[model samples]
Target: MTGVRWILMPLLTSAACVAQAGWIDEAELELRFDDNLPRGQLKRDIKSDMAVAIAAEGGRGYQLTENGRLTLTMTLSATGYRQYSGLDHVDAGVGLAYRHKFGLGPLAPEARASVSATRLEYRDDGRDGWLYSAQLGIGKRITERLGLTATYEFERRKSDDVADRLLPTVAADVYDLTSRNFTLGGDYTLSSDYVLSAAYTLRDGDIVSTTLRNLPIFLASSAIAEDRVFGRNRYAYKMKATTRGASLGVSRVINDHSSLTLGYEYIDSRAEGGIDYQANIVRAIYLHQF
Candidate 1:
C-alpha cells in the first residue's frame, strides 16, 4: 500500500499540471474594405455595372488541448452597386472550426475541419438565399517560417425566386445547385511583419436558370440562338471551372494580438464553354484581438 501511494501521488500531480496547461482562450475582430470598381475586363464601359463592398467579421477561439483548438466566427457585410441601380444588399455568415496538430520525428502535421452557413438578401428583388459549406484540410510545417496546406470543400446553395410571375404556368421553377472545390496553397513568412501566399483552385458545378416569356417568332428564335451560341439560356448548364491565383502582401503587427494587412490578388478563371474572366483586387484589412 505504501509503494502504490507513492507512485499514485506523483502521477496525479503530473495530470493536474497537464490539465492546467491545456486550456486557452482568444477573440478577434477583422474589418476589410473592397472596391470591385471596374477596370479592364471588368470595365464599367463594357460591363456597365460594378459593386463595392465593405465587410467586417468577429471570431472567438477556445483551446481544448495543447495541440487542439476550436473557433467560431460571424460576419456582416454590404455591397453598393453602381450603374445597375439597386439598393445595397446585406450578407451574413457564421462558421465553426477545429484544428489539431500532430508530429512524426522532425516533421509536424496539422489537420483542420470547418463548417459555415451564409445568407444573402437583396432589397430590389426581395430575394433571399442560403448557402452551406464544409471543408477539410491538412498542412505540413515545412520550416519555422513556411508551410503548405491542401484542402477539399463542398457547398450547396438553395434559392427561391421572389417573382412568382417569372415561373412557368405549366411547371414550378425552383433553382438549386451544388459546388465542390479542391485547393492547394502555400504560405511563407518573410519577417515578423510580412508574409506571402499563393493558391490554385478547381471547381465543378451545375447552374440552372429559368425564364418565362411570351414573344414573337423572330425574337424567340434570336433568343434561342444567342443562348446556344453564347451559353446563356433558361436551362441547366454543367460546367467545370479552374482558377489560378497569387497574392503578395505585407502585414504590420499592431501589437501582441492585432494586425493590419494590405494585399493585392490577381485571379484568372476559365470555364469549359464560357468566356474567361480576370480580376485584380486590392484589399486593406484590420484585425483586433480581445
Candidate 2:
C-alpha cells in the first residue's frame, strides 16, 4: 500500500465532492473447502483443507462528473485454515476505483478502473508479501434480468529474499510472483431477492507446486525451496503455468443491508513440462453493507 493511498486523495480533491458525508462500510464472512490446497503436481502430494475468512471495508465516494464517481477504500481481513496453519494470515489494503456510465438508464454501459496494494503476513515467513494489482472492467445489461461483464487484471507479489536455495540452478525467491488474468461473467436475477451468477477466468502466471522431488518438474521449474509445512521430504517448485477456472454462485438478499451467497469453483492448471493439477472449491458467505 505504498503509493495507491496517496493517489486517492489527489483524485478526490479534484472532484466536485457532491457525494453525501457518510462512510460506507461492508463486512463479509466466508467458509470454504478446497480439494487441492497445495496445488501439488502429483497425486500423492495433493492435500485438501477447509478455511474461514472474515473481512471488513470502509470507504468514501466523491462525484467527479455527472456520470462518474471515485471511491477510496481501506480493507482488513483475516483467514484461518483447518488443516494447514501455515496458510493462516492477516492482510490490510487500500484501494481506489473510478466508475462511469454512458447514460442514465439501467441498460447503460458502465466501466470501472481500480488499483490496490496489500500487505499479507503469513504464518510461513517465506509466503509474506506485498500484493499490488490493477483491474479494468466493463459491464452492460443484456436485459432487465440479465447482465454481463468482462474484466482484465494484472498483479505482482513481492516477498522476502530466500537465503537457502534447494538447488544451485534454482532461483532463490520462490514466493515472488506475477500474473495476468481475463474474466467474463454473467448474472441473472431469478427474483426480486435472488440472483444467479457464473464466470470464467483465464490466467497466465507463476505457480508454486509443493511435492516430493520430481526430476521432470525440475526441468520446468524456475525456483526451488524446502517446504516443511505439509511435512518433511516435500519441496516447493515455482513454474510458469496457464490456468483456467469456472465458478457458479447464487446470492439471496436477506434484507436491505445483508445478503448470503453459495458458490462452487473448479480450476485446472498446466505447467510447461506437462505437470498439472486441479482443484475444486465450495463456499458459503454472509455479507452486510452499512
Best by TM-score: 2
* CA shift of 226, model 1, Å: 15
How does each model score on lDDT? 0.55, 0.85
C-alpha RMSD for every candidate: 15.3, 7.3
**Pairs of residues at least 3 apart in sequence or in different chains that clash in candidate 2:** none
The Cα error of candidate 2 at residue 224, in Å, is 0.7
Give the Cα-based TM-score of candidate 1 against the true structure: 0.63
Whole-structure CA lDDT of model 1: 0.55
Instruction: Return the lDDT, model 2, position 35.
Output: 90
User: Per-residue lDDT tens digits of candidate 1, residues 1-290?
Assistant: 23223323443354345335542122222232323222112233122233444455567789999888999987665555544323346667899999888954334798999999998765444335787899999999799888899999998876655223323332222234577888888878888877777677676653322122223221212111111111234222222345566666677787887777777777665554343446666666665544
Error at 32, model 1, angstroms: 8.6
Q: Kindly give the stretch of ten consecutive residues in candidate 1 with the minimal lDDT sum.
A: 221-230
